[model samples]
Target: MPGSEAIRELVAACVGKVGGPLVALRKIVSAHGHIDDEHVGIVADVFNLSLADVRGIVSFYSDFRTTPRGRRHIRICQAEACQAVGSRRLTREVAEALGVELGATSEDLGVSLEAVYCLGLCASGPCATVDERVVVRVTREELLR
Candidate 1:
């Protein structure tokens, strides 16, 4: 959401002089919570990348977001192991409880739900990561907590 000059300065600060588009994008996302269209332009100009290039990289990565995210981010594992443990049901129930579908943020900005393929905790599946902390064997009650 920063202006061109501000974004340039921010990227420059992070990269010193020659900034990488991917790295600058990460910086913007970390600082601003998401990258808007304006940010994509700034990143493209500053990194000598095309707008399409920036958009492609952003969309390809699960970590990047085109819009603002909620204060708390929730990622549920949907891998085979997690699915075997009822992650699909868990995802639906959590979505219903939060009133937001997968890959959506609540209107109140409390939480954003995303489906992740794996968390490496498959053995303890139905795993979830809340605000970046992995929670194993997650349940609806645990999500509400």
Candidate 2:
């Protein structure tokens, strides 16, 4: 876990420069595997930041995680526009069929399910996600098969 001291130092340096401090932290989280007890301590200690400041950054971003996340993060739009096109029905069946809850990943690492407010593809509606990619006009069969 500590093999990359040089990388750690590089991270420490770059972290303070990018936009606000919070944005820097988010960059690190995206590059690294997961943020947990170790990251919380190391990031704070290396950057000479406070624990409250670090945790505060995490709380602000929906993308940030205190625990671990699946290798892939998936999102399904539940916007009114999407619902009008049957995204609600699609989301329910996809979650059940995949055996994963909203905001949770399947144990097998296939996908993670999340409800998104909108994807700006209202014309397509019925939006879904695979990893970071947004899939529009998705069907239950499309979500599962």
Highest lDDT model number: 1
Instruction: Identify the runs in model 2 with alpha carbons over 4 angstroms from their true place.
Output: 1-7
For model 2, what is the alpha-carbon lDDT of residue 1? Answer: 36
The TM-score of candidate 1 is 0.90
lDDT of 1 by residue, 68-95 (tens): 6888888899899999989999999989
Q: In candidate 1, which residue pairs get closer than 3 Å at backbone N, Cα or C atoms, i.e. clash? A: none
Q: In candidate 1, where is summed lDDT lowest over 10 consecutive residues?
A: 11-20
TM-score, one value per model: 0.90, 0.79
What is the Cα root-mean-square deviation between model 1 and the actual structure?
2.0
The most accurate candidate by TM-score is: 1
lDDT of 1: 0.85
RMSD of each: 2.0, 2.6
Output the lDDT of residue 115, model 2: 85
Task: Score each candidate by Cα lDDT.
Answer: 0.85, 0.72
